[model samples]
Target: MKTLKEQFDILSDGAVDLLPQEDFIRKLERSIATGTPLRAKLGLDPSRPDIHIGHAVVLNKLRQFQDLGHTVVLIIGDFTAMIGDPTGKSKTRPALTLDETRENGKTYVEQAAKILDMSRTEVVYNSQWLDSMSFREVITLSAKYTVAQLLERDDFTKRYRSGEPISVHEFLYPLSQAYDSVAVRSDVELGGTDQKFNLLVGREIMKAYGQEPQCILTMPILEGTDGVEKMSKSLDNYIALTDSAKDMFGKTMSIPDSLIARYYRYACFAGGEDVARMESELAAGTLHPRTAKVQVSGSLVDRYHGEGAGKEALDEFERVFVKKDIPDVIEETVLDGTSLDIVTILTTTSMAQSKSEARRLIQQGGVSIDGTKITDPAALIDLQAPVILRVGKLRFLRISGR
Candidate 1:
């Protein structure tokens, strides 16, 4: 069993805030002495079923707690999903049906299993308890917090000041989320920085219910591959957990050099000392950003995939991008000997979104056929033999004429 200090050191790494830090240390100490695992709660909004490295920031922290022999309470927000979490939203969020909510939650646990220990972890659906509450019980739960307090939350305040509509149910969203801590008896709740308000509310709600207030730990929001916005699927700036090993490595490499330290720590790398050392080396002009990015990318790929897959991805990346060599898994598409528009072929091969985009790519010197650069979007080429179709970087297709 890990000592309290050892556990704290690991848990605090990359965390943005550990509210009531003293209380967390005390709980950790008690757990170590009594061999009773602290219940670390993390509520998942099933509305977003897919998780990226950004989401992994919190999941990685949970993994640390699991490593320290702590209990993980993965609260699937099926009940709250119907209500929709109003965190960081500018406008009212559209609610999902119970069926939609439940459907999304199914794969959520499976994806989470990639990071959490399923056998030791306890998965619970909020609907199980939230649905059984009487109106009076809910009213009593509501009595715990005030409207003024809820309005003080960042999103509500911004929405109100901007003259946007604030649904009454949106106010209850935090209360419902808070109630999860009460139901699960969470000793510590982990979330991204944006979720601080809700996490703090859970602490207060737990006190109101005559339980020990759960400590809140918020992790930093990971920047996307673009290095500008938060990693999000809506923005297409996310690397999905299910991405191919090569794609994942390639995406990690695409992140700005400035984010190398963050990606190394928050994405998957476990050693805080090592991440710090790497950052120090970069700052001291001892380590190049490109080389550091390769390490970060390799670690991320190796974590999700395997050592072999990680090596393959690293080699493929170096070969395709550095050595100007082709990848191993170029798709072989058999097509009849037919004349095809360059734009049409590019779009058909999923290299670009539309003909206009394909044309733009061609004009930008990003489209090639059989290693030959084709700058003319309107050019039609007759496919007579197998030829490799390349688009920008990281996309390839071998078109064969039959």
Candidate 2:
């Protein structure tokens, strides 16, 4: 049988770069040998309801640990969510109400279970402990780290340098996250590369608490569908786990061809051999980027929604996008003899945002009318029949004529 660490390496496809792999492996071997499964912690502030594929990257890694007979402690930062984590934010996030946090937390578990094993995992809310602590106790905990040390964080440092408002509460966010490790006595913790500084603080706190320092594993950030920035819902660049099969497949297909290999390695469970084969095919010119993208999208949709839906979505993509065929479903808006211009129809149906913008897009070959590209600013519409309006690659709107 392979060692636990070896199993993890295989499952993660060697994408994770542990700070000290050998030390962690030795510790893991000893923990397993002694029949004591290591405690692993992953924290998520439920500030947002939508969980994207980027979040799944970490959850999938946690699942691997759980499968290896280790304890997986999921920390829901209900308290922190209210304060708003200052991880990647330039400006401090606006505070969320307690009721809002509670309501969002309830639905988050359902989405989280799509990636994490809720039955085997130990689900915890940080508010349970943080809320009960006294002010002096909080101060005592706060003293563990210095202002200088806290300011070292990139976001804080940048804000301080650039004269941006760095809220005082922001300093306490990582301190609270660090205290979570101490509270759970976590043996190992996982986060994205952007979270390395926060994860490292957990080790310091764990040591201060007289427990063995937790091993930190940071995974690479999954690029958003834009194929650039980290996957984020606010950026409108995410493929939500809850997104329908058709939407998921379409969004995945929309990603730039350059992102396919990276997505395969991190987002999906494609192994070394599978990835190598795909890369070889791309290198040898046997596979086109679109075909490869379709495969990638199909596999992802199948993983989330099921095989049948994946195939349907794939077919839908081919018909609607590749072949420029009409979609199965199109919105029908009744025209009630009220005079409506083409620009108004386009903007109202969300085919375009404004008349000026619509005209610009049309001139750029980015707008189409009934599957035909339209470039005239003064294009008139007779609302006596149904016509489809398309914008760029993904948006479609149907306007019915009176």
Candidate 3:
């Protein structure tokens, strides 16, 4: 078993904030002395179907706890997701149906398995207890926290001052998420910085219930490829865990040079010491940004894909992108007509969602045929000969006449 200091160092390496650090240290000390593992809880509301590298920031931290021989209690917020967390939202979010939340939760667990040891991890649905609670029981639980206190949350406070609609059920989100920690008797809770309000409420609710309050750890939010906004699928700036090895590598390479260290620290498998050393070398110009980015991108691809997938992805990337050579394996599409307009060709092959989008791509010089830019959407393609279609930077399609 690792000592308290060793465990603390490893667990707190990439964390943004460890509330009541002394308390966490004491908890770690007690757990180590008692030969008992701590229950580290992480509540995930499957608000979206996809899990991206942004979400991996916290999961990776949870994995560190698992590595330290602690029990990881992964709480699927099936019940609370319906209420929708109001954190960082200017307005109340649309509530999802129970069916939607459950289906999304399944995908969440499956993707999380890539990081967590699923066999040893204890996965529970919050609906188990939240659903069973009577109205009176809920009322009694609600009385534990006051409305004034709930309004103290930044989003709630801003919405209240700005005259935005704040639904009554929205208040239940944090309260219900707090009850998750109570339900599982968690010793530690992991969340992103935005979730600090919710995690702290878990600590308070546990105390009110006469249980030992769980210590909360917040991980920093990862920046997307744009390096401006937080990684999000809605913004189309995210790297999904489900992306193919080549797409993952290509996307990673697109990030600005400034984000290389940040990505290495939070997203990659590099330890704290290694990350620091890399940062130093980068500052001293001993390590080139492109070289560092290549390594970081490859590491991420290897982690998501299998063992040798990174090398394969890197080789393909160099062949197609660096050398300006067409990929050896391009998706093929056969058309019924011998000739078609560029707009029709784009939409027919599912490259563009709509004709307007195809026209826009053409106007922006993003669409090319046989390595020649197609500026006019009305341009006709003579598909009698196989034409290589390139869209934007990475997408490619081989079109041929039937």
Tens-digit per-residue lDDT, 77-121, candidate 1: 999999988888999899898788888899888888888999889
- Give every collision pair in model 1: none
lDDT of 3 by residue, 256-322 (tens): 9999988988888588788888899999999999999999999999998988899999999999888
Give candidate 2's whole-model lDDT: 0.82
| Candidate numbers, best lDDT first, in rank order | 3, 1, 2
For candidate 3, give the lDDT of residue 152.
Answer: 94
Highest-TM-score candidate: 3
Candidate 2 per-residue C-alpha lDDT over 1-402 given as tens digits, one digit per residue, 9 for 90 to 100: 467757656534544557556657777778767988878899988998878899888888888888877889998888889999888788989999877886777777888899777888888888988889999988988888898998888888898899999877888889899899988988888898889999888888777778888888888899998888889987779999998787889999888888887787777867778888888898889999888888888888888887577799988888887897878886567665444666676677766667787777878998777767877767776667777777777667777755
The TM-score obtained by model 2 is 0.84
- Candidate 1 wrongly placed segments (more than 4 Å): 132-134, 333-392, 399-402
TM-score for candidate 3 = 0.92
- Compared with the true structure, all predictions reach lDDT values of 0.88, 0.82, 0.92
> In model 3, which runs have C-alpha deviations exceeding 4 angstroms?
333-360, 377-386, 400-402
